[model samples]
Target: MLSRARLIQRLVIFAIFSFLLFVGSQRIPLRSNTVPSAPSAPSPARDSSYERQVQFWKNLHNLLESNSPATDPPERLKKAENVLFDPNANYTRPDLFAISEGDVKQLQQVHQRVVQKIKNDNSSLELVYHRGKRGIVSAAGRKYLPTLVISLRLLRRSGTRFPVEVFIASQEQYDEVVCEQILPTMNAVCIVLSGILGTNVVSRLEPFQLKSFAMLFSSFEQLLWLDASCFPIHDAIEIFQSKPFTHVGLVTWPDFWSSDPSRFFNTIASKPEPPVSERASTDGGQLLISKKTHAKTLLLASYYNYYGETHFYLLLSQSDVGGSDKETYLAAASVLDEPFYAVNEPIRSIGHRNANGHLDSSATVQYSPTEDYKLTNQGINHVKDANAGPIPHAFFLRTSYSKMSPVNLFDPSRNGSEEVSPIRGPDGKPSRAWTAEKETIDSLGGPDVEREYWSHVRWTVCTLEGLQFKDWKDKEGTCQQAKEYFDAVFAPKDRR
Candidate 1:
């Protein structure tokens, strides 16, 4: 009805107003005239629990820093401030720092508080993860990727329906190809340690400390933790349903040595001297724990590992062989007065003979917990005389000498034998690592586990194009050697 210019202006104003209205509708309600909603009734409890968890970690950090500040070097290692072990050499007794009575008392006080809190707090376990999930967990660095790959392949081959979570220490260790491409195919996912614990806390940890932390931060309510080099021979899901595991909700295997704790540790834990029969050091190569049952135990174990380099490692181990984070698990459970079952079976060694006449044990085989439990109840096997009866079935095989990695399996021996590959025995003979394990493997009346292990290793090195293969100097030669060795030692004997 108006003139042309006026009508055009009116239409433009209408269009602008409509466009503005659409944009306004996309945003949240305007802050003005908006009343803030009150938190739900349950929010306060959850918030309190979260705050307590945060404070617990903070307290640990402060205590550790006060006693063994990373910035200050111990007098023993004048040349190296934060480094505990030599870069090129193996960890030795000299690498340990001395702890004082005062240090022990302070640690004890903190631990006492932790115990009391768990006793008082109903929300302790629930804060970690909601109940009703189970999974397997392992930790690996970039260097250990090959071992992890082989271990995981063997795990999947064992037909475990449980999911797997592989924890890496930092962002630097995460491989996009491995994490995103390879692991998901195997029903495993990579969890970066730093992402859950934060960098400040993770920076204080070492390889020995990673395992407990992995178990703590993993989302599973029931956790089966395996070392990167350890693999199960069969499905392990039934362990959760077994009487031993269900009764205590925690199970650990035994190392060969006695595990009498240092006198000081006994005093701190307020535990009596452990009986020789019940004191077999824990072989923590693999373990099962239910967070629903032992949340306090896991938290305390994490604390032990967090302060291990300075205090608990030596306290529990007392310079025993294979001591690192191994003993902390049992120690924590014991401290919490939680019932835990330690398998009543001997840990047996398996390996082919080396150049020397003596047997060079490579991997240690652990027994099935359910079988051990049955034998114990029947009085056929006792912790005091684990070897008195027939060995329980070999459930887990943990590699020590070589971890089925291309570098360790095919490369020149680090012992300065230029021609001797790790996979071979005397005279460069193509031999299985478990040549000495034949008697035990055959006695089980099962398919050759060693052969199955090698087949997986061959598949990993020869077939899979995953990033772990990048460690191989001569991928073709390595893969060929692995295949040839398998064909020679295992293939002809593959009865299955």
Candidate 2:
């Protein structure tokens, strides 16, 4: 219809118009067919949760910094300050720290109430233990309950006035059963914990959380925690009366393997320098805490427990040997610049009785001649020898050579009716029980003594269940040579 130049111009215009339409179509999202993109910003609930977590940690930091004791050394204060202010610090996991707005408010309220309670009751001291259920019906838990009962019985016998509190982490029905049946007999108060903190972590980490944040469940100003395995043979009240415990708020003992601090320190990523003192070894089985003196220490310990495995990957590894909690406690104490009193004299916590009648106790026990054996700066006597006084506060009785069945100790149906007794022979005679007269008679040279000694030695035979003890016939290479084999499997990578 038009000339050649006009036709060309018209076609070019149409092409440009089509291109413009295409660009417009691309810019405008299709409402019917297009999949909606996620919002760029976090939802209001998520935003609120994150802010609360941030605020929670910030408040905790402030609390630690402000409430730290005046006596705290400059190094410890500085460490606390650095950890609190560090922008990169993984203080808490957002999900675990605050599950919802309700959780956030509840945590704050509980924390405040606990703090207030501790402040109001400065003179009160309480003994607390934690028991976490292993299964719907826990066999190990049943064993532990009797152990706790024995310790409480000993404590009551020793005239301890402090109330015993048991923290049970189990189903509501199980808790009720324990409360109604077991706690009633023991005269102990039972508190059921929700155990929400660090629940996502491995099973072993649960102990760290339970022990580190023990104050959350405790209202007392001073708290003493005893492991279920520990048996208080004497009045533990004497321990609190001791100068070491009174002077220093936190007190612990050395581990059996207490050679190197570097082995433990290396397990922590921060790699805090161990204390210069000889008493740097950690035994967390027994701990005495003073709320006012060790509040910051407690917080630091809890923080380490929460973030320890993350910082030190070795803690999460198989070769850790369940020492991560102990390592974290020691590291936190060191960082806090707090003095943790380690009794110089061995506390006869773990005792082994051999067939020879000579007690292979922890290095701390000694023979005493006095009727009222005084507890000196040296550790308490665990073994009661001839002409020896009572062992003061002998906590642990380790019968590792012969494993006693839990069935012998606890009956869940009967609620632990079995009375505690010494290891007995087939003839019903106490195997390990020794009398001064018998020892004297043995020393006087008699054929009867020889027979009796041999009889005692025969009882030392290993009776540990599950593992078969086979004597190696090939005497050329001792099984002790397998130390390296075990070290490779169980030892930490750094140690190995």
> Each candidate: RMSD to true structure?
10.5, 25.3
lDDT of 1: 0.68
lDDT for each residue of candidate 1 in 213-313, tens digit (9 for 90 to 100): 77876768998999989888778886878879989999998887656456667766777866434446778799999988888787778777877876677
Q: Candidate 1: where are CA atoms >4 Å away? A: 1-104, 124-126, 321-323, 382-388, 401-403, 413-415, 418-422, 443-447, 463-476, 492-496
The C-alpha lDDT values of all candidates are 0.68, 0.38
Q: In candidate 1, how many clashes are counted?
A: 0
Question: How many clashes show up per model?
Answer: 0, 0
Which residue window of length 10 is worst by lDDT in model 2?
A: 74-83
* Per-residue error (Å), model 2, residue 263: 7.3
Instruction: Name every residue pair that clashes in candidate 2.
Output: none
Displacement of the residue 8 alpha carbon in candidate 1, Å: 39
Give per-residue CA lDDT, model 2, range 23-93, as digits (tens): 98889543332211111011112232333433443454344334322221111111111111121223421
Off by over 4 Å in 2: 1-143, 195-204, 263-272, 275-277, 307-320, 349-405, 408-430, 433-496
Local lDDT at 29 for model 2: 45
